[model samples]
Target: MIVTADGSAREPNFNRHITTPNMRKKSINMMYQWFVVSLVYYGLAMNSANLGTDPYISFAASAIVGIPATLFSAVILKYLGRRLSLSGTMLLAGITCLVTALPWPANLNWVIVTLATIGMFASSGTYGICFLYSGELYLTVVRNIGLGSNSTWARASAILAPYVALLGMYRREYPLLIFGVLAISASIAGLFLPETQDQELPETLEDGENFGKKQRFWTLLPQKPSIDNNSAVEQ
Candidate 1:
């Protein structure tokens, strides 16, 4: 029990514990999302050399794509908002992987490599946007905890990424199929995240509790115009 603002004693709300359902749901969603993102991102890198090109050349190509992807993410984050940018990139990455799943000539290994490279590029963009978006999702007081936990998922996914690529030993397209499905799932999960663009950050636990309470959809719509209080006073 504690004194209230009016000096009345009250029992604390035990329902809002760290293990509350809301908190658990948010944590689990973020964990899965980050896991899939890292899996696809690193899977592409690990499988690049197996696309029939010289190992050095394929690795170089994959590494180089990150440069442009990082540059493009700045523009996307500014104009497109965080949710759309992340979801769209993840979807694009998934699509590229799916394309390679289709049966193609053995000599078309270069095409497969190109598509995989594009997927990696999009995944890199997702990486940049996801970190920014996730940081904004949690309250400032627990920001590090939230991000650190999500990053732990990313590391776990990275550890599994090589095994995902190793599925190529069974079938060349197996890795692509798995990564493609995971990327698509990540994009779908992204759609559920609230848009944080132009919104004030939550500075306290109470402030964060109500964050994302408004479940608005199709965030790309033009924002509603706000009335100017100063203009009303002048009038």
Candidate 2:
């Protein structure tokens, strides 16, 4: 047993979470992940006009696209698992945006517009998944604190998103390239986090300390738990 700052007794193992090197690393990484995700997601959203579409139409279309993307992300989260779905969508979003950033002929404006909308769709999906992922990743005791802290970072991202998009004023592709790089970076960072889809939410600091230690790659495929007993029950 251990006593906390508030003089409360805790489970004997609970103290380990406070001192665990892995836990600290994961927490710091997640902070960066949330910031990057928010920055790119909103940056693309606010700068939709750069896609060469009517700004009003693009905004409405982006909102409409998000409806289905959210529903589809639920299915993606269920089957593809959190890690792959996030990384895949983010990678797709980044690639599509980078495609627009290329020095293509003006004749390809329609292609660029199409890619921007697709990137928006992917970014929306990634943003939604992050909400679910962050909620589940934190322990009950500190879940609100963790989420609040992340939200603050997200707001910071939101504030910077507009300025980042302003780069497009100087060079049209500047914002697109920036969004692409950040989205891809977020995807890579996501790879380091554990898959949380359908898995039991961490209820205590100890559970969080041990979270993501189990390897259940590609929840899309079927696997026998005979080899690893924890596999079947983790999700």
Candidate 3:
């Protein structure tokens, strides 16, 4: 394992995910991912609020939504991809949340609730996609830990969420806006990672590289070199 600048030992393997020969099918798998995940994830989240007309209804609706919603997540993750599922969930959740937050007709409260529910449904799908997809994508050695890390981080958000809500939520619509922005951000982060819907476990570093692909990261560079031969490539 190579030591990164921060002195941490990076994974010895290069391919961050498993590989599948059928690239087309694997990539196509992504399309189903987002919508499916959103169906489950955001569904549960919104149920606590969007499920009904008032907070109590929302709470009751949220509880009701969780039952079938979780089951659906299981069903979809069995068929869809990890990356696509997650990204789709993020996008749909973000979009729908944004839509719900918009200033529309007073009569449209029901419409907003409907829209919010749809986003919640998609959120569950995303949760499934992320867990199953990433687990299968990575090699055996790191698979559990990698997926675990991801799962932990995700759970952390949920755990801390109530605190966040308690801290801020001045406006009635503020939480929706926050959720919308967060969903968008998560989708963007999903794009930065690799796609591993249906594939074989990567055996070598090169395999991981081929699968994961380079992504945007911070870089530090020194100034340009001088124009001399001693400074060879200098400007």
Each prediction's TM-score against the native? 0.86, 0.81, 0.61
Clashes per candidate, residues 3 or more apart or on different chains: 0, 0, 30
How far residue 75's Cα lies from its native spot in candidate 2, in Å, is 0.9
Q: Which candidate tops TM-score?
A: 1
- TM-score, candidate 1, is 0.86
Per-residue lDDT tens digits for candidate 1, residues 1-235, read 9799998999988786443455456667777888888999999899875566577777887899998999999998888888889889999999999997788787887887788789989999989887988888877778799999999999999999999898887787899999999899888888777777777767876666666667566655324345689988998
Tell me how far candidate 2 lies from the true structure as C-alpha RMSD in angstroms.
5.4
lDDT of 3 by residue, 45-152 (tens): 533543235666555544565557667766654554444456666788789877877776877666766776667666755665565666565566556665555555
- Sort the candidates on TM-score, descending order: 1, 2, 3
Better of 2 and 3 by TM-score: 2
Clash count, predicted structure 3: 30
Badly placed stretches (over 4 Å) of model 1 are: 1-23, 221-235
Residue 201 CA displacement from its true place in model 2, Å: 3.5
